[model samples]
Target: MPHVFEVGELTRAIKAVVESEFPFVWVRGQVVNLSRPGSGHLYFSLRDAEASLAVVWFRGAQGGRISAGGERYDPLTGEVYDRPLAESITDGMEIMVAGRLTVYAQRGVYQLVAEVVQEVGAGRLWLEFEALKKDLAAKGYFDAARKRPLPSHPVRVAVITAPAGAAVRDFIRLGRERGHGAAVRVYPTLVQGEAAPAGIVRAMLRAVADDWAEVLVLIRGGGSLEDLWAFNTLDVARAIFAAPVPVVTGVGHEVDMTIADMVADVRAATPSHAAQLLWPERGMLAQRVDDAELALRRIIGTLLASRERELAVLARGLAWLSPARRLDRLAESFDGVDKRLVRAGTGYLDGLSRRLADLEARVSRRFDARSLDAREDALTRRVERLTAAARMFVADRQQRLELAGAHLAGLDPAGPLTRGYSLTTVARTGKFLRRETDVRPGDKLEIMVYEGRVRAVVTDGGPDAGDKS
Candidate 1:
């Protein structure tokens, strides 16, 4: 009888045989039934007509997207292989997968554990793109510090794009509709295909050499990676870097970004956006002007009102300093001084009289007839001395009073004015004009004398020639 084995054992035995025989293999086919679960393990079916093989690409595996002449790494064994694989393996792409043929022990099924995946034909282009991007980045071509600011309101804009394309038309149309009066000069050029790089370089050079516009705009409509590949060329990127004027790039759609966009001073989302950026809308500009004018008017009105209030205050002050007012104040001060002097004199005299009476009373009370005679003589002598002292004090006080009165009279504002000496004050402000700077040309000055005031205008003046006296 033939020996019989358990089902699991039999499956394991067959798996070992297949894996040992074809430990590593290369399969080329269209990807299908791709499933990437939460494990980050990529699962798909590699199928070519009659045959189909299950393949798995684990995340963080040794292998990455394969490029032409790039090294291939084994995901399962962590070993480098001769055959390279593409970094990304997606459904519907025709790719060459290099991995180890392995057994799924639990399910007891055979599958290819993909380590490397390479795009069938476009691997070289992708390699070149990545290599150039790395080189340019190393040279600081994509540095943010190198980027320049766009002009706030570019009066003249030079657009480099295909003349008949929608990009140029869109740019021009937007400019005409909204760009106040910005001039849009067009330099027609090919934006794609093999001749595109050379055409773009020439056009950029021409725009810079001729100083065509204040700012240069490079724009094109949306297309696939290959369709927009021309913008990614090294020549076009260098030209953009070397542009004399600020460059604004609006290539392809919003999702697509090329090397030109990276190197440009500004990147817009679309051709229409580029136009809007290069020019300000006429209505908006007009509104801005109107706002500025209104603000200026408001500021001027406030300033004028403030000056008017100041002038009014000065006029009021000048009125209060008039001759009549000054005379009235002086008269009131004189009356106060006279009353104080009279009160002081009367108090002193009363105190002296009281002292004399007290001294006489004390002598009468304490002295006998002979003593009284002697005391009376002494008292009379004392009286004479006191009288003399009182007379001298009165004289002194009288002299001081006369002096004070003379000083007060001299302080009279009318005193100087009455002597033909005029008091000059600033025009309209009543500020005492002491120096030449106090009054400028065309200034109206008030000249006040004893009789009245006169208004005079200053035609010309110089620094005072020192005090003569």
Candidate 2:
């Protein structure tokens, strides 16, 4: 009997067998058809002259776990190597890849899942560079917010570079021409080889500590990647990040970007560009100063004109308020008032003279010397008669007043009291007591006599109780 298998069943059986037979392997070839989709998964074909194999590297698989040279490692921790294999890989690069063979069940195709990768020639150095870059980026050293703006016209620029190199010379010459003769302080440092990173870091620290310049420029001429590897070191990147003042980096050619450039406050394409960015040309600055002076003169002239207008207004007001003018007006008013007063006085004196003459004429006609003598004699007779009548009236009134006084004296009640008679009154209310029934036996009494008043308590008061009243 012949048996037929289903398509899905057949594919699954083949996938199981191929994956089990080649679970892990190492393949060496030139990379081609490298494509990274938006999902961050790398797909490529490792091809030789005769054949090719499909391979894939997921984004998460980059620093997950890898094995190289018969040893296992965690690329994230830098346990065994400086960097993971993924970072050093590129298209057309001859590489040795370590991975597991896996089969896609849907397509029924077998592919290599890459775990580790390494470049053929410059594998180690590129790996270290990648590692340091990743580390510093994770620590926020390459944050855009931390970058500082460059000075527009720096008066003093401190340069950290090799003194003997063409980079320093170019920088100094350009700064002199464009920077308006800015002072350049060169902190000579080794820009290549083993001792370069430490030397650059120390120079940067010293430049900052000494307050050397307003802006610091770290420059080096264009070189191969190996020649410029010192600027790509972790120490140099950190030094640039930690500088107190703004740091400008110009390392290698325009195409090359080192870690120092990424961490610096500002990145320049070349040493000459760094100088141009730091300062303005002398001729341009002189033009700007001249423009500013013209603007200042215009402003001053406007202000002076406004002040002069204000002073003229004040002078007009002061002229109106002058004391001499006020005194002149007052003198004019006084002259008018003095004329009116003189006219009034003259009119009044003439009226008085006319009235005096009329009164004198009336007196002269009405009264003669004989008539005045007759009036005097009549007045003397009347005065003698009035004197006699007043004497008679005064004597009569005096006699009548004496008689009335004698009558009032005889009728006085106090006069009776002085002649051995006494008057009694109830002491509580001051009522006169005329009879025995006027008071009670225990009542207090006041007796009025000639010399003094006597206060006594009544022992007996009713007629039936005592015979004497």
Give the Cα lDDT of each candidate.
Answer: 0.79, 0.78
Residue 406 C-alpha lDDT in model 1: 87
The reply for model 1, stretches above 4 Å from the true place, is 1-122, 280-328, 331-469
- RMSD to the hidden true structure, all candidates: 12.1, 28.8
Q: What shift in Å separates residue 90 of candidate 2 from its native position after superposition?
A: 16
User: Which whole-number lDDT from 0 to 100 does residue 98 have in model 1?
Assistant: 70
Candidate 1 structure lDDT: 0.79
Residue ranges of candidate 2 with Cα displaced over 4 Å: 1-127, 331-469
Query: 109, model 2: CA deviation in Å?
Result: 9.0
Residue 155's lDDT within candidate 2 is 81
Per-residue lDDT of 1-469 in model 2, one digit per residue for the tens? Answer: 8778898888778878887988777787899998878888889989999999999988877764444333334442223444555665678889867688887777767789987665544445666778888999999999999888887677877899999999999988888788566788999999999999999999988899998688888999875456778998988887888788899999865556788988989899889888878887878899999999999999999999999999999999887788556656655765675567557655755665577567556755787878756755765575567556545555565565457556655555676877799988897668898878777777898898988999999888755556754
Clashes of each: 10, 0
